[model samples]
Target: MLPEVNATRYVTPLREGGSLPGIVEADNHGTYVVKFRGAGQGPKALVAEVISGELARRLDLPVPELAVTHLDPIVARAEPDEEVQELIRASAGANLGMDYLPGALGYDPVAHPVEADLASRTLAFDAFVENVDRSWRNPNLLIWHGDLWLIDHGATLYFHHNWPRAGNVAQRAYKWDDHVLRPYATNLATAGPALAAELTPGLLEEVIALVPDEWLAEFDFPSAEQARAAYLGHLRTRAAAWPAWLPGAAA
Candidate 1:
């Protein structure tokens, strides 16, 4: 389970994305970028962040540490903006907090070229999860201490948005021409099997278990366990069909 921390202060809103995440200080004396439960995307987005981020960590990918942040309604009083205040008030409960990376620079492929192997692995991971947000137009990656770190995985596992048809789309191929790392992913043939082999049923379950029950409750699954089972099943199916979905695998 992720460590729980209460919000001690709300700093400012991060205007980079539409969700309106904010910088916050927690009782643990740690600063974080908190993705609110009240955002238009709701708690499901938070669930994807936890599952995908943790899975990346397990795959030896860099990702910020995540925690369950508790927000109190009183924090809304400090905000003068009625719109922001309303968002804060609506998110007066469990939210997702990503450890803030101070001084991290946005990744620019031209300035910081990625290695072929690393790029292939990254593309493979995104393909497996059906993440559609890592395009050049909005690359959700950061560079800290000269190392790449994946962020903002809220757009992943999109199939969950329509559970009834998740199976039909689970095997859909990833469109990678616009991927920020596509040019550097020349070793997908090697990276695909290497990464897919690591995503065992047990490993998938371990990663899914990291998501909070409250977020899982919003889904139609009868229980959190059932929801986890569904996620694992979809991922397993995707992994088995990797040759069809992984970009550059045939090359």
Candidate 2:
């Protein structure tokens, strides 16, 4: 959805991304790993990731820089023609584009040693607010050059499954008692201010405006302006309700 996503940049397929991933060179002069889905993921998934990633970055989380990208088919065909590779390139920007992380390693919460308690708490807040895309098998958290990076947000909010009619009240009630959320909730208050400041009116508007018009139509989320206001409200409430038990809770 970013206006900056260059459609003409030749996206070269990288052989490695498990499935549906094509690594491409971004205009920003950084290597990007992208996962594309022709008709399966739909544009909304990409939209959610872009929006949320930007939002998280604003919240002072360790999310990597990201953008929406279009893959060039000719470049894709240049590869050896593997099924997954072929599919990934064929599905380019229409489905996904990611800014590649250099010197990063995958991480599990239990195994990570740098215990920045506030970072953990903020990430959990993200799960509660966004109905996150992570799980046990694919936590999607990466350790790049000694820093943690969040990825694979394509499944968060599960909007595609619920959008036509978020009719079920249950759908709105994400279980915050899960392993990740339960541990972090205690620290939400201290982390809340930094996160709150990140969701500034300007930042929210800038991100919402990036949503591609095509994706907006397909996903049927609230209108961009309305969606922006709603997201702000959601963050505000989270900030207000942050628990006082966290480290540096006085913040």
Candidate 3:
């Protein structure tokens, strides 16, 4: 489970994405980019964030620290925006917080080229998760201290939105032509298979177990346990058929 922290202050809204996640100061004195559970995408987005971000970290991809944030609606009383205020009030319980990375710059492919190994691994990871947001227009890749970090995983795990047919989409092919790191993923043909092999049942459960039960309860399942089982099954199925969807997968 992610560490729990109480939000002490709401600094400013980051207008980059639709969810309007904001920067916050926590009781632990740590700064974080908090994603509210009341966001338009709902708690499922937060679930995807925890699963994908932490899973990426375990796989050696750079990801900011994720924590379960406790927020009080009163913290936004002075905010002028009605929209922001309503969002704060509705998110009066547990939300998601990611450690704020200071002085990080947006990644520019031409200015910051990645090595083949890292690029291959990154591409493989996205493919395995069925991420659709890592395109050139919205790379979602950041450069902090000369290393690349992946962010905003809410857009991955698309099948969750339609649970009944999730299995149909499990092994669906990943179209990587527009992937931001496609050009540099020279070793994907070799790396993809090796990386897929790493998503064993044990490791999959480790990452899935990190997701909070409250968030899992919102899914269209009989119980939170079933939701977790669904996620496990979907991911395991996709991982097993990686060669069908993974670009440059080896024979």
Candidate 4:
């Protein structure tokens, strides 16, 4: 399970995205960008962040450490902004926290060219998860200490929004023409197979296990276990049929 920490303070709100994530200080003395469960996307977005971000880390990709943050109602009272205070009040529970990158800059493809292999693997991973947020308009890629890092995976695994149809969309093809990394991911043919090999059922189970039970409780699944099984089933099916979804694999 990811380290669980309680929010000690709400530093400030990050207004860039619609979800209204905020910078918070935790009891561990570490600062994090917190994605609230009260956001419009709900707990499912947090689920996608954990699953997709952890999977990226397992694939040797650069992703920040994730933690489960506990928010107390008291934190909301300290916020002066009415809208932000309301958001904090509603999110008085488990939220997703990403390790804050102090000096990171947004990735610019032209200014900082990525190597073909790394780019290919990133593309393949995004495709596998059906992430649609990594477009040129919102790259969602960061550059810290001269290395690339992936962040903001809340938009992934869209199938979960309608669990009943998730299995049917498991084999859906990824449209990569708009992917920010597509221009540099020329080696997808080789990268796809190599990365897919590492995503074993065991590894996936381990990653899915990191999500907290409370986040899974609100779902309509018979139990948290069933919801987890559904995630595993959807991802496993996608992995097995990579040719249908992997960019350049059909060539």
- Per-model clash counts, in order, read 0, 6, 0, 0
- Give all TM-scores, in the order shown: 0.96, 0.71, 0.98, 0.98
Model 2, range 1-251, lDDT digits (tens) per residue?
Answer: 45345444445555444445666665567666775655356666666677777666666667766766666565555556567545755464454566777677777667765455555555544543455545444567788877767676666545345543433321243444443424434555545455544545566567656766655554445565555455455444443444432233344
Badly placed stretches (over 4 Å) of model 1 are: none
Q: What's the lDDT for residue 106 in model 4?
A: 93
lDDT of 4 by residue, 24-141 (tens): 9999999999999999999999999999999999999999999999999698777899999988989998999999999999999898899999999999999989999999999999
User: Clashes in model 2: which pairs?
Assistant: 32-100, 69-93, 70-93, 71-93, 104-144, 105-143
lDDT of candidate 3 at residue 215, scale 0 to 100: 91
lDDT per residue for candidate 3 within 93-165, as digits (tens), equals 9999999999999989999999999999999999988889999899999999999989899988989999989
Give a tens-digit lDDT track for model 1, residues 1-251.
98899998998899887999999999999999999999999988999999899998899888999999999979878888788899999998899999999999999988989988988889899988888999999999999999998999999999999899999987788888899998888888888779988888888888898999889988689898899889889988877777778776655
Q: Give the CA lDDT, 0 to 100, for residue 151 in model 4.
A: 98
Give every collision pair in model 1.
Answer: none
Name the best candidate (by lDDT). 4
Worst 10 residues of 2 by lDDT: 166-175
